[model samples]
Target: MALIEYRFDNLRHDRIGSRGIDLQSLDRRSMEQAIAELRALASQKDITFPRLPEAPVEPIIARAAADRKDFSDLLVIGIGGSSLGARALLSSCTPGNPGCRVHVLENVDAHEFERIWSGLDPERTCVNVISKSGGTVETMANFLTVRQRLLDRFGVQGVRDRVRVTTDPESGILRAFAQEEGLVTLDVPPGVGGRFSVLSAVGLYPLAMAGLDVEALLAGAAAARDAALAPEAESNPAICFAAHQVALHDAGTRGLVFMPYATRLFDTALWFVQLWAESLGKVRRHADGHTENVGPTPIAALGANDQHSQLQLFMEGPADKCVLLLDVEERRDLRVPAVPAVLAGLQHLEGQSLDDIRAAELRGVRAALTEAGRPNATLSLKDTGARSMGALLMFLQCATGLAGSLLGVSSYDQPGVELAKRFAHGLLGHSDHAHLRAAADRAGQGKALTSVH
Candidate 1:
């Protein structure tokens, strides 16, 4: 099988003639150092992401198989890393799986909260609440809301029967609650953080239970991890991807433009946005004792669609964007049948397929961007199937890991997010954050707006 191909032809200054980096001759010692750092992180006793591609699938399968009889719908409850990967997967792949739809509750917005609450029957729905820390405020809020729905319908006994949790193995409030209630619990490995936990039970259990091929997905990721580990810098796509992104960032490119040519892969871009933004966007630098803020903003756009809306700005607005184009060889296609002789003006579309048209549009934009001297790269997939999707995810994950290493930032931790969580809890009357709430009240007391009524 042809693995996804990443070509940097459009990213070279020789091709763009000015805006790009000469990654071909640049010293790779730094790249090697970054990889070494990544290896060091993997070697540390506390991390699990490096070995995630090879994570066992049997346990996940068994859990899914066992839960299939009682739950028709899988309701994933969590925010950010907890739900993004699973959402992306089910969004992109579940159309082909002969299984019940997966509903994800990632926010506390009234509409979203009530929509999911109303759709699921507590008796038939399996609620998988995933939170690595088990105390993420938004996740906990959703879990409580959903738990009550179950309680109201099936009472305490049925609530335990339909509920499961994927969280820290030994600690956290969720852990304590699960153990106390005798809920089926799956461990969210200590080493694997939420964003990187897809290969673990956090993602696998729901997918496998939904009747999708978890092994094939893992196999694809394993292949990608192996490919990324290739010692040769030029041949390792992960290394190259990291290098290009770093070089561009250092060269003053402020935005990472991910515009895929396919519509189905849009959520993949959203998933990448979270992975890229949350992981690489950092302040503390381990390499040099760090800058307070540094990270490329990730922008998502869909081809043929965004071409009309965002292409103008990208082409003429600023030279601070690096475009990454992606397109898959269409797995299925529909022909534009010959038009009636009475409608002769539309003959140009006759006999042409939508896939053919889309592919051409994809090529056209790549050429247009090149001609515009826009630094870019293209990730071409042979097909938009699980294997290639798995490879793409793993490739990007490896790239993100190395890119953070190069930037000297902590890729796995989100120290800044903790402040907001604390402030939010304080506002909500949580005793632990009471002091923060007091501080917030003091801070906001004098800031009320004065306006003419």
Candidate 2:
């Protein structure tokens, strides 16, 4: 069996509840009705259910990887979905491998700009300035700052050659600027939101630069898409997984803790948190027009590290939390150590090798979590490669969408973010709302704002 199938089989046997739900119990007529409703809801508005790209993105990624593009580092400038997904992919594929670093500048902190500038060599660095709209203040501000820095370090000629753009084709200012300057460009497809653009070229370029196998990644994603679309409940892993999570939430577990064993996946957890929180968070109105809060609270934790910190709260605090553990079958390329003479007489300790100790530790953690009845699920990646990471990304996206549907919320829209954006713009003197600006000025006046409480 392929590695993907084996890992999935292990998940099925070890994680899924054997008898909690059966499709047959719903009656064929009722099952059809539920599916029809789900399909209709998924298709409504600009929401497009996940689908495999008609032309594979692998070859394109491979070409990018093989190109003679000489750049020391690729500076990705964007916020939220524009930057998070690509950062997750790059971090996972090369956990500790030291190559050209993929530095993502998502925030407008001046200190971050100073740090990036300190490390970057303008002559060798390539900048990928990404924004769906030409008008995101944070992104545009960062772009201008970085461009000026590059021009100062090198001449105008160098700035023009090193800067690239990824944005909407015809409408955005960035797109127009790239065209005028003759800089290389990637098109961000219209109608696809930033959160949903990971599988698109937005993520492909960075993954290629990180030396991941893009083809294998796409294949795994394609397999996952197929499974999500399957009719059979047993064959469809995404549907089964989503149904279980929904059942758990309805039964009173509304908080989700994403715990990944490897430190590199910490950023991936953040991305998932945004996807789940933003997508499902909404004020839903009933037949009588009554509204209610209907989204899960998401938290991210790194394993081994969090095993010391937050595990206590999770284990004893409330029974209303569900944990998802992302465990890898093997780390990229670390070898087992040889036995030493630190301990003399423990039965297995004297002769056991390092691999034995590592394996034992992994087994102990899984067994302990399972015994605690924490309602935990594990995603086992065969190895941290391009394909495995790609498959994982697609799997989580589909699972989250299904979970949202089960909870009766739209998983693609994020209307709550607008309020914060409006507030921030007013604070920055970009909005016409005078009251908001006045409030922001008063809030910024206090010494407490600069000090840690």
Evaluated with lDDT, which candidate comes out highest? Answer: 1
* Regions of model 2 farther than 4 Å from truth: 1-49, 55-68, 94-100, 180-182, 331-363, 433-435, 439-453
lDDT digits (tens) for residues 148-202 of candidate 2: 8887878778877787788886788878888887877776766567887787667
**Model 1 / residue 145 / CA error / Å:** 1.3
Worst 10 residues of 1 by lDDT: 92-101
Candidate 1 local Cα displacement, residue 81, angstroms: 0.7
Off by over 4 Å in 1: 42-47, 94-97, 284-292, 340-346, 438-453
Candidate 1, backbone clash total: 1
Per-model lDDT: 0.82, 0.68
